[model samples]
Target chain A: MTTVMVVDDHPMWREAVERDLAARGFEVVATAGDAGSAVRRALAVRPDVVVMDLQLGTGSGVDATRDVVAALPGTRVLVLSASAEQADVLEAVKAGASGYLVKSAGADELADAVTRTAAGDAVFSAGLAGLLLGEYRRLQAGPDPGAPQLTERETEVLKLVSRGLSAKAIAERLVLSHRTVENHVQNTLRKLQLHNRVELTRYAIEHGLTDPDSA
Target chain B: MAGELRQRDLLAPLWRVVVAFRLVAWVLAVAGWFRERDDYPGTAAPVAVLVAMAVWTAVVTVAYSRAAGRRTRVTLLDLGVTVLVLAATVATQPAGAFGEGAPIVTSIWVAGPALAMALARGRDGGVAGAVVVWAAVTFLRGYVGDREVFNLTLLVLTAGLLGYAATITRRAELALREAAAAQAAAQERERLGRAVHDGVLQVLAAVRRRGVDPELTRLAAEQEVALRGLLTTGPEVAVGTADLGTALRLLATPDVDVAGPAEPVELPAHTAAELTAAVREALANTAEHAAGAHAWVSLEPADDEVVVVVRDDGPGIPDGRLPAAAGEGHHGVRSSICGRLADLGGSAVLHTAPGQGTEWELTIPRGTPR
Candidate 1:
């Protein structure tokens, strides 16, 4: 059974998320009102996924997301916030949140986002996905002219990522094992010091790893 | 007020008329004396007085035209010169030659000092100076006749009327100065109103529109009222300096952490208010945008400046986000945060990027010279 932890400053919001996850057949391991306690509870429970609010009273949700990801890389964070700001979405993404959903999202959508995050898929609200994609393209245009050269296989993975292909899909297309593809992705991430696929895709586009015809 | 006499536009024509009259008196006195040359046996004394009067009138005409020449000392000396010339005419004239129809050396030239004193010191100075000259004439004549008494009263009345006119001119000048001051103050209030409109009022309106929490809406309404009062009240006219620490303390709340020196950070009231307003706008941005954020504010006073830092632990503003926000009509960071500091001759530096939190350093110099 999938396990989830809810973190929100508002009692009602935390309770609602907890109830929704429970009704969806997911076990809610714990709930917290702030970043510190959320991190502590997340570590103790080792929930498969954490549904976190961006604002957590006196603590920061972004910081909590970072802590949880660092402490338990196996655990995923799905941020739910009242703001649909581009900066907020990007920050949460850079902090290692697997998904971001606004509070205005329906219960079903929240449940679906949580399931996708647990299944290791990056989830985003409707328009936010495109916004992040556009931001990635814009950021890619301006960077080191002398970018680190990528291996032939890393470039192939980069092209697939830029075309918005999933890692598993890229592995199947390339006739490689999923673990080998992930290792290539990790190697590129280390060379670039980028935190996520979003940045990597942007870097690929800037360095002309992706073809316009393929995209 | 030192150059009040010369500054009187109303008196400029009067001064010209007085000068013209003195010139006419000199011409007339000379003509009258020459026509009645045989009437006075001694020519030396009257001729000497006549020459002195001509020289003095010529000197005064040029001197009074300049501001430095219009000093109180010069006015009094002019009066003394006229009085002595009048008295000398009496001593030089043969007995009974200064009777009715006879010409005095000063003639009507005494009007110069009478009108000048009125312009300088208003009614009282005019009346006093006229009386002094009138007494010298009466003393030399050696008898208080009907004509002498009539002339003395005439001098006093003319001086009084001229003095009254001077008082009116002075009052008009004062009123003009006060009107100019009021206009400047109104302009300042208008500028302050615009700043408030861009900053606090916009935040409050946004909060009110969100309508998520009733308590937040109520707080916004309360602030709206307070902000309106602040805009209309103009800058406070309190005597003592404003304490920056005390003003900063007012911003500290349960969610915000404020740290500053125990000693009062004494600053001019307007500067303190500007600095505080900038800080308030920064806090408002954090509350409205940064989710689950905690804020910290610190103040450090350097040798000649005060450094205030406001930081938040939240999803930091992304690179290029501010410019993008500006394009999308976000004025909080532009007008409220930076504009206010710029007006006070201070600077606001924003430090932020994606993933990292945001911090702002506001540095304002001491003793703003508004």
Candidate 2:
């Protein structure tokens, strides 16, 4: 069973989410209410996935996400927050969160997002995908003459990656070997110093590598 | 406070003009003396009397130019000196010198202190300053001539006219101060209205929507009580900048977590308060409508604007719920949340759907928009 830890300030909301995930066959390992303890507990538990909220008492979920991601390479964070603001989504994505889900998401959607996030898929709420894409377009419009260039194949894989396509999916669509797709993804992550596909997607999108026609 | 300073500023130039007029009068007296030198009875030294008038003019000008407030003794001394010089000229000159209508010593210089006194003490000071000068003229000639009486009338009129101007200036300053205070109060009231409309009213509306669900009603009641307390206490008289991060923290509880930048996201106090209030409204909605909702608040400071996001982990608003709510006269989403931002030259965007949680993106630019 996949192990998950929840970090949110509210006890009732935390318990509800824990119950929902537990019923769905995921093992709930631990929970934290504040940012400081969320980091400490997350490090100790090393859960496969962390269901995190952006707001904590005097602490930040984004900071905690960064700390958790830094400490555990295998761990993925799925931000379960109330805010759908583009800046919040961007910050969490930058901090290495694998997915962003608003609190209003159904238990099923949230559970699905958590499982997908653990499996290394980037998930976003309904309209937030468009908002993030718009932000990426704006960022890509800026001048960055010194930015490192990617090869044609790597750029193709990145464009697919930014469209929220999984490595296996990108491999299938491009008729490339799964191993070859994974290699391109790893190389892209290294070049951008990004930890996960989510960050890679953000970078690709920011560099205008994503194709609107393909999406 | 500024109004008082401004009133003094306006009066200061008038004082300068009065001093200049006094100086002009001294020059005219000196010229009249030189042109009529041979007409002197020879009883008084013309040069000595001319020298005294010139020295007094110099002293009066210097005293008036100093930026001192309420120089009562100096003003009194000025009036005293004028009377004494006029009496001395009459005592020294032969009776024949008075046959020509010109009063020899310090002639028109008598009205100088009257203008100063009128500015300093209003009409009363004007009348008193003119009284001493008129008395000297009356004492100099045993019987006052028609021309001398007319000069006395002119002295009193100058005093009265200046005194009235002083009164108007003071009244205008008071009106300006009152208007400023009223504006501040009105601005604060509107901010308080926005806060109430955003937070408390939304909670109450949520309770109304839930309609007799005991648990939801109980939660709504608690919020209603809190809102009532806030309304009764009223908003603080906000001034200067407020830390957006710090103000946001107050909206957090066990269920609600507020995260912000380490650095202060400072905004104008009213804007910060309004923004925080809008965030609180978002939280209140989550608590009231979103079942078992966990909400988060995050602040991001950009180059030109501060972005505040209030998110909740509850079943989100239905697709048409906001418009429906507005149609039903539920203004929490409209006026308190969006209208407040509009007033500040900012924008509020809401993202939510059934089974998805509601989030508010509040963006306020630095400084007030024109």
Candidate 3:
């Protein structure tokens, strides 16, 4: 069974999600109500997937996601948040979340997302795809020469995804294999994450928060 | 309540400054009377006027401190006292002493009323008060000499400039109050939005996900989408323009998914409305003809054009179905979608097969008609 951890500030929501995931055959290994305990609990249990809520009442879920992903290399984070927080969702993704699912998703959809996340597939919503497309376009328009660029095929696949096409449908339309389509989607996210990491390191070095020799 | 009091007293500091100025000017007048006491024919009238000037200055000082006390009647009374003091200079001075350039009994203290008038009204009132004083000075001197001309010019300039400054300060205060009110309103809205998101929206989403009753689920889903749209909308756009992304997001329902960039996609307000209307028509058609079909609307903003794609995963239109519908006087697709895009100097292309889904690609060029 895929081990899962749920983090939400609302006790009702946390319990409901825990029950639903347990009913769906996933092991409910750990749960937390805020960012601090979330990281601590995730480190203790080392679950296969962490379902994160963006608003934690005390601290940021993005920080928890970064800490959890950094500590456990085998674990993946899937943000289960409200759809309205686009900027926070994007930040969580850059902080190393593998996928996003709105809280309104049914139990079946939630299970499918968790399963795919555990299998290392990029579970994207159309909104996330749109945000990534916009981010890439923004970077292209920026002054940095070393900014990441998407291949033409990746852009095409991302556009289809933004239009609410499933991976299987995108694979059939682009004449690519299903795993290849998933890889393209995953690669886009990986590049964004890599760029974010580089930017953060550069910022740290410039601000003298990190020693250049050690960095 | 504190902000209301502060706003009401925006000019309180200005009035205090004016009072300080009057006290300083009154001291100068007293000094002038003392210095020229030997030059006057009789000291009693000048001494009486000096005492009256002292009493009036204290009265106006106390009166102007409060907002309710700074009235037009007080300002007019102030001007009347200033004129009487200036006229008294004639009785105190020796015969032909004005021709020798002896200073007036009130000296610089005459400027007090002019400044008060300026603060109460504006440039016009300041000029009017200065002119009244200038006329009294001219009558006392019996001629417009170089000294009288110089005094008139100085008084008018001081009153006019101070009046202009007062007007600017009032305008800036009003603008600041407006901006602060707007920011406070926005912050309150954000707080309410957070509360709604934390409590109400969560319950609604849970209800929708439970799917206990189809109608209840549908209502909950619609409210969730509507509330999310309201909370996530960008700041108000400039007049004559609208964020197309926000308009598109409002169309999102359980069966129809709308996606757009995080940044605002602004277009001319008319263009955005027409494009939204066209998309609504397309979604309505999908609901009527393609039962149980899920629709997707995506907004793509490019360099020189905006593209909207509405696709449905229902059974596609067969060959010649569009033309056949047009022939049968059903102009839904012809007039509503395609014709609307055509009028916008854009094009709508439909792609479909018998078993495949239907897709409508609508493109509108930027900076067209408007």
Candidate 4:
């Protein structure tokens, strides 16, 4: 069984999601209501998948996602949030979240997302694909020479994904194997997360937050 | 009344400086009177005048400190007392004093009323008060000599500059207050939005997910989209342009899904309107012909143009159906969707086949001809 953890501020939502995952045959290892407790519980439980909500009572799911991903490399995060919280969703993805789904998704869709996330596959919703396309465009507009760029094939795959096409459909259209299409989608997110990490390190070093001896 | 109090508070610092000037000038006047005491035929009247000036200075200082006391009537009374003190100079000085160019009994203390008027009313009031003082001095001396000319010029310039400074300070204060008010309103709106998202929107989502009744689910979903749009977008853009992404997002319903970039896709106002109208027509066509069909509208922005793809998973159009419809004078798709794009210096392509579904790709270039 795939071990799962749920983090949300609403008690009702936490229970509903827990019930849904339980019915779907996933082990509900733990749950948390805020960022601090979410991080601590995830560290203790070491679940294979963490379903995160963007809005916490007094803390952010993005910070929790960063801490959990840093502490356990084997775990993956899937954001379950409202469509209006697009900016926060993007930040969570950069903080090492693997997938995003709207809160109104049916139980079957949620189960499928969690299963795929546990299997180490990138789950690209049409909205996340759109955000990634816009992010790459914005970065290319900047003056940085070492900024990340997407291959032509990756851009083509992302455009299809943004148009609400499934991975199987994209594979059939592009004349590639299903695994290759999934890899392309995963590469786009990996590049974004890598770039964010490099930028943060550069910022810390420039501001003298990093000691010279450590460097 | 509140506005009057705020105005007084804004000008309080300038008024303080004016009162300090009056006290320093009064001290100098008293010193001059002591030095010329023996020159006067009788010292009794000079002593009385000096005492009156001292008492009046204290009275006006206390009055100007309060908002109710800083009125036009009080300012006029202050000028009247100043003129009276200037007139006393002629009575207290000897005849030889005028010919010998000795200083007047009021000395520089006469400028106090002009300074007060400048801070109270601004440049015009300052100039008017200075002219009244000049007239009194000229009448008392019976001449406008070099000394009188010099004193009048100094009084007018100083009063005018102080008045200008006070006016600038008051305007700055009003601007700062307006800016702070706008910031506070924005923060309040954001707080309310967060509260609504935490409670109302969450419940709505949960209701839609329950799917107990199709009609209830539709209504709840529609309200959720509307509320989310209201919280996210700002006031509508200006007349010349609009965000196409925002316009298209409004078309989203339970069965219709809209996807676009997080950033705004801006286009000319009329262009965006026509494109939105075209998309609406396309969705309407789907609803009419393909019952139970789910539609997706995706916006893709490129460096040179924007492409909107509207696709529906439904029974596809039969071969040659479009040509036969055009022959039968059915012009819904041709005129509504394709014609709109044609006018925008773009093209619309429709692809369909048996069981393959229908898709319309509409492209509008950024540099379209007016």
Strongest candidate by TM-score: 3
True lDDT of residue B22, candidate 1: 73
Per-residue C-alpha lDDT of model 2 across residues A110-166, encoded as one tens digit per residue: 789888878876664322333333333334444754334456787566544533345
TM-score of chain B of each: 0.52, 0.49, 0.54, 0.53
Model 1 C-alpha lDDT versus the unseen true structure: 0.70
Worst 10 residues of 1 chain A by lDDT: A126-135
The candidate scoring highest on DockQ is 3
CAPRI classification of candidate 3: acceptable
Model 1 lDDT per residue over B261-290, tens place: 334567787888989999999989988889
The CAPRI-style docking tier of model 4 reads acceptable
TM-scores for all candidates?
A: 0.36, 0.36, 0.69, 0.66
Clashing pairs in 3: none
Off by over 4 Å in 2: A84-90, A126-215, B1-370
What is each candidate's DockQ, to 2 decimals?
Answer: 0.01, 0.04, 0.40, 0.35
List per-prediction Cα lDDT, in the order shown.
0.70, 0.69, 0.86, 0.85
Candidate 4 lDDT, A98-181, residue by residue in tens: 999877677898999999999998778887898898888878988988889999999999988887778998899999999999
Q: Which structure among the candidates has the greatest lDDT? A: 3
**lDDT: the better of candidates 1 and 3:** 3
Native contacts recovered, in order, as a fraction for each? 0.00, 0.00, 0.41, 0.33
lDDT by residue for model 3 over A17-104, one digit each (tens)? 8888998899999999999999998999999999999988899999999899889999999999876677788889988999998776
Q: Which stretches of candidate 3 lie above 4 Å from their native place?
A: B1-185, B235-239, B327-329, B368-370
Model 2 per-residue lDDT tens digits across residues B1-370: 6565644555677678778988898888778776776766563566677678778878878887765633767778888887777766865477755655544656687778888888777888888888777877766666678877898899999887897787677677666765787688777866885676455555564453343686775565445434433333222333466767557645644356554432355677788888888888877777788767777676656668877777776888888889999999988889988999899899999988786577788888886433
